[model samples]
Target: MDEQTGSPDMATGSDRIAGDNIAAYASSAHSPTSESMMSGGSRNRKRSEVFATHESPYFFPAHQLYNVVSMDRSTSYTLKLAAKIDRGFFLASNDWTCYRRNYFQISACFFIPGLDTTQQPEVPCLLDYNGELLQVNRFLICIGAQIQNGDKAIELVQHTPKRDKGPQITPKRMPVRAGGDLSPGPTGLQPYVVTYERVQFKTATANNGKRRAAQQYYQVHVDLFAETDTGAQILVANLLSAPLVVRGRSPGHYADNEDDDAVAAAAAAAAGAGAPSGPGTSSSTPYPADERYPPASSSYRNDSISSSNGGDYSYYPNYGYNSSSYPYQSLGSASHMATQDYREDYHYNNNSGRHDSESYPASPLSPSGPHPHAYMTPQVQHGFSPAASGAASPDMYSPSGFPENGGGHYQYGSPTYPQYPQQHPQDQHHHYHQEGQQQLNGQYDSYNGGQQYDQETQDHATQLAGLRIHSPVSPSSPLIGSPTGVTPRRQSFSSALSSKKAGVGIAGDRSSIGSTRKTRSISMSGITKRAPSKTRTSRTVPATPTKEHHSNGGALGSIGGVLGGIGGLGGIGHGVKGLGISSDRIPENPMEDQQS
Candidate 1:
């Protein structure tokens, strides 16, 4: 049965001519019914024009492996050739198909032990299509190619000294290993496999009027395995290996006569009349991943969807939301463990009770600490604390000169302190009126302006006082004119009130707390008059040395800590105040923050 002509229909002379004409008609019908086919051919042509495009993979099975030039590793085992041909062509070529003059160029890259450098590796074996060994073609050798043997890997590339060679011995192509190959080791011992493929098609004039072009291609892929027997049958396990990656060319052959101008012109006219269409070669820039598809690495675990695990993770994205592209969730037991860490830190601050603030430790210059009123309120400044002598330096509060004392303590008697107000008649009357009022419950019953206000009204007054009030007048504005000792009166009043209302000390650590509160009060009094704000300090934890200490072992640990502490958390409490972040509210686990 003539399969290409589809089992010829049995008939008489009339039927036979009819069938022949129909066959010719059918063969001539090459209108490329599918757009995908045309597009693929156009794209392939474009690719061939822009960048050198290679042909489909070549196939030279095991029996023909050594028919070509071959070399033995350790003088015992022989590397075999096993080309995983592109399925497109493989399906087209069935068994028992004899091809002629089909020449192929092949070279083998093998791993050997004694190499000192990473770049100069060994290139073994060269052969032609007939399996006839070629003369030691030094030009085909690749040294300094990266190879890995278990833990020790090195780059032993072929160094082509200044000699006559076909091509420059630059890094020929990126080295790729077959599936299940181990990564390059630190030590300089690894092996690689290289293969080559070629193809050709010929036509001839015969008695028959039919025209035809014969096509033939070759692919040579290497299979390296450890073996105990000298027969080279037993496949030893691979300690370290990569895919069967080859770097070779796919040169298209124009028939000898076709290579000439007259032949080319005749061939063009024939193609114009009725020539077998070229295979719909894909024109799409074969995304490197698509250009070659290898068998899935056997070493890849079934559940590992990511390419990180030696698996193929190629995808084409559409504009709309794609569930597959979303941040992938692991499907294994370890998935939940990943979530625990995230949720731990996230929940911590969500419910933290104590106000979180950015502490500015007092300058350790004048025996005293940060000013009592450095912050808007004493409670708000609670987050700041002096570092231990061996720790990092105290905060930089005032960029100006420190007090004369090394402890940062300044006396009120210093000339820098403004004088207090005199006992004016209006103030006296207000003081008398305030004495006349009685405390309702434990809270104050009168406002700062001497108005007898209820509890709600007192709360409202305090809130209004904390609101940042802008000073329209510049420091050099006319508003700086005399307030008649008003500044002194204000200082005395604040001092008196802070002294009387120093509530229970937080953390029960009173040594610096009392002084800190006092310093906070004084600073607050000053900042309030100028840039009024209830600025609170955020509690800052000393950063753990994640990066430097655990860089090699745990990359994420250091990264997470560095992110969570200084930079990530530092910028949070800048503008807002009274953001109480108590310990109980914050989860103890730092990982709690990982949850969405």
Candidate 2:
């Protein structure tokens, strides 16, 4: 019940009587704020922490001293004993008291953090109860009872706690622990054994005007067993008195430990032996081991002791002793767990995709390479002019030490790896003659790998070859093709032959060429390959006729005219050969093409 409600009875029935015991409030004066309770934190500390640091506002520690509520000086209660251990033997007592001045009532019941009700680790108290017999019952439990010399006698009760407000004032009829069952009462007024002790909860000054001693009420603790010289003994010791009851217990094992079984077995064996016993104990003993369990009380045998330890392995914020006495909680919903796992997988898949460098953009710091460090390394053995070569500067080439594609930039099948040269427009026909000759002679394979050259690759190679043609026989020689418009030579034939011999690589007189027109055709059709240059030029300069020839070569002067007045190199070549002038060179017998 909520303490704020202040109902007439907060909790009714046995729940109230067994609600919070005196052990829950022994340190009520120093009770922690409601926030400090073990909702869930480092709550499963050692048991010593409970007694020292914990407190409840309305409970007293159990197994401690308790004071009687009221006592009457006018009445003197008498003590008595039971006749013998016999069933259906109706016996009454004048020993027990339920009268007003002798009986007590509870004023409050609230819990303090002390120990659990299960008594798992060890037995704790049942506090805030009245040991008073407010009503009479046939099965009276004589508290502080003893057995000696085959007779039962009542022992004196001891303890002194103040009479304070508690929860249950009447007799409590409930199990010792929350989940256990209560044994049935014997007769109409069957009572079970119980006792009480006292505990000091709080004591301080109270003042209406000036300071004064507080009119304080101490806590009372209830106990289930009493202590004796023989050993610790329960008040309601044995209740299985019937014969049929004995037969029922004969089959089942109640105790987990073999020790209890041995004790019971030993007692049974001792009784059955009956080796001529004494007169008073002469009657045959029945199932003497049939001892009744404490009614409405928890078992303190503690079968699972390992759970109570607060060691490093056992204690955690979520488990240990706290879990044993309280309800546990689940972590989260199923969907939430699935969502978290999916998020992790999503990130992993994306990362795995990027494991290939081709998936991402290139780095800005360094570029990929022909050589390992192509972008920045110097070229020490550059064999040709940059313009002629159609190559990037030496600084653009990579060093041998680095990867060909140093920056991981290029995708598969990049155009950068092949160094295809650019074509020079002026040299196309020149290279074409040489290329056709090679094709006829089966000299070199086509640069295009037997396939036709793509426009780009053809352009590059043509430009490179055109720049290299600085031949000894300069096409710019005046007599070869003059600006005076393809006129006959002014000098003698010997001078021309000597000049030709000195300027070109042929050995015999020019007359030997007359024997084979096919050989002449071969020479006219192709330019012989030149030897390699000793020192490469850096600048690329185009060779051949000047711009004037290119501009006027397209126009023909007449049918027999050789030099075209206008147009490109092709037009000029065709025009020169059409006339019987022998535009390239005259045969040794210059009269031959003239005679045709």
Which lDDT tens digits does candidate 2 get at residues 397-424? 1111112112222111112312211111
Worst 10 residues of 1 by lDDT: 358-367
C-alpha TM-score for every candidate: 0.16, 0.13
| Highest TM-score model number | 1
Per-candidate clash tally:
101, 40
RMSD to native, candidate 2:
61.2
Give the alpha carbon lDDT tens digit for every residue of 339-369 in model 1.
1111111111111211122111110000011
Top model number, lDDT:
1
Please state every model's RMSD to the true fold in angstroms. Answer: 44.9, 61.2
Where does model 2 exceed 4 Å of error? 1-44, 48-140, 147-154, 162-195, 198-596
- Quote model 1's TM-score: 0.16
